[model samples]
Target: MSRPALEVADVFRSHGPAWRRAHAGHVSLDQLKVMSAIERCRTAALGGHVARCADCAYTSIAYNSCRNRHCPKCQGAAAKDWLADREADLLPVPHYHVVFTPPAAVADIAYQNKAVVYDLLFKVSAETILTIAADPRHLGARIGITSVLHTWGSAMTHHPHVHMIVPGGGISLDGSKWISCRPGFFLPVRVLSRLFRRLFLEKLMAAYAAGRLNFFGDHALLADTQAFATHLAPLRRSEWVVYSKRPFGGPEAVLAYLSRYTHRVAIANSRLIAVDEQGITFKWKDYRIEGHNRHKRMTLATDEFIRRFLIHVLPKGLHRIRHYGLFAKSACADNVARARELLTVAKPEGEPTSAAVDPNKPSCPCCGGRMIIIEVFARGATPRHQPTAPTNRIRIDTS
Candidate 1:
């Protein structure tokens, strides 16, 4: 694929230093590290290998990726590998896409206590689903869920939400059968919403009592106990957002959906249009609108754009994707095996699952031949052997 005309790295490379100076004490260490990683990713600073095509003798330099989870340029390969690992686990049943979103008020607290609140967002949302699905009046089956946290809205604003991909059914309580839901339905959204709101608030209050929650800036008043209770009072009465989409066509469709969402950064390089004196221009979807009008271009001042992006830098070591219920790590293998057996579907053959291209063996653009690594370069070192000049030779930046 052709490189994007512009990238978040380009913006950071040009303005990051100045932005860092301007924000001085406000930026977090994780955000600073993310910026540095993106700037140096796929550059000589990370080192790489030089490859020569076996047939055409074509040569190219492919720099090493920083492999930072927040780097837009690095997620494509990561997502591919993750999807490959998960391909075998997909049940041959319809899957539902459900989203859990806290209101703006709660998002404010999440902004200040990301690690704590985001953890609750994942835990509480999963618990809510598990509770609802296991109720006798509901599906009465213990479902599995793969949840991914997304912290940015289409416009790069801080909108924390969890996207869950759930198999339409689960194993019965007795472990005797594979229980499936109605063809198009999963769980009641209203029930999920109310339970999520109550459980999240209860957990949030517990966290506050334990001093795990922090308050700063405009929320400093929330540090007081009474003030905090008052803050949460309105939220208890308000409705939280929980919605489910139509079921996917099949397991392939579910895998395709997971591929796009699993490793996505806050913004992708492809979404960037240009970086200029007028600031950064990028595509954003205004969900409040309908039809083609929802797709629009937005421009933000460089400083503001950088600030918005940094707001989404999650606390270090916090996981963005997690598995719950049957897919949980403790029993995933045995559970998947039982699920396949109950569904009466044969286990997928043990074949090579990954289709990601090996960076060390690139295809020759000229003759489609496998390229072998001719030389390795260390960090901050350039390749010693350059490709010889030939009129027909094409130079490619495989990085």
Candidate 2:
């Protein structure tokens, strides 16, 4: 297929050199490699083939996709897989998206202790959600939660927050009946905010005491325990920010939202609008508006763009997607089955064959017949045998 009008690759190809010159002494090689990899995601940089359809004789070229976890082109499958996995975990009731933000006091320190503070963000926010929802006075049922960590804002600013997609219902404590939370709202956002603040600060202090949090570079100021304690002092004085968006329409809506977050890094490819001799332009969502129309365009220097992009490159091996309470990965499946039974809901059993029949977008290969799978390769392994038509099939060219 033809490339998009203006892609990350086009931006990199046109302006990457200028960015390198401007930031020669500043940026690291690893960071540049990541940018290059993202830009070159599904082009000739990675080899692919031109397939010819046998039925229609349609000729088309298929380029390879990067499959890099951080590449925007590669996320469709990852999101699909994750959504499928979460499908069975859905409760009969509506689901809510919960977001919790650390105070500026903690955000500064979090900048340095990304891996640590981000970990705290997930654990604390999740505990707050499940704990508050479990109260007999509230829902009286445990809630299944999937929390994703986002450490950057539209400007690539280090604004750490947890985006939690929670099923409105959960399995009973005894795993017998399906417990459901209120439809319109779950836990009170204000209450959740305070509790989240307390849990996060308490745990953060524990990390500081145990010497688990890291402080360096721009964060060197927070290294001293006294300074760190002071940094956290204001948070105790003010309430933390734990905001819950209105419940999604249903499970499918939840998947659509989760798809946007699951494989995303700091930014998405669609965000980059242009790369000219001057700088780069991007589209950023301004949540201040009433709805999605709140999003607007933004511009940044090439070097600044690169810098912001790298800020979110998570510490390697840290898991950003986490399951909690009834949705905990280890035991969620069995629990979901029991919950479905109690709710009297017949859960979908999924499609017959899941071996992604046509993983790629439909292309007209240059052949008389439609192209179908002749050989299957598990990953990059060479195909053992390929299907071929009687007339077009070439004999084994052993000679």
lDDT of each: 0.91, 0.72
318-369: candidate 1 lDDT, tens digit per residue: 9999999999989998999999999999989864534345643558887899
TM-score of each: 0.97, 0.85
Q: How would you encode candidate 2's per-residue C-alpha lDDT over 59-147 as one tens digit per residue? A: 33344666666665677777877777766667656888888888877888777777788888888888888888777777777777888
Give the clashing pairs for model 1.
none
List candidate 2 stretches off by more than 4 Å: 17-33, 289-293, 352-357, 361-369, 372-399
Leading candidate by TM-score: 1
Top candidate by lDDT: 1
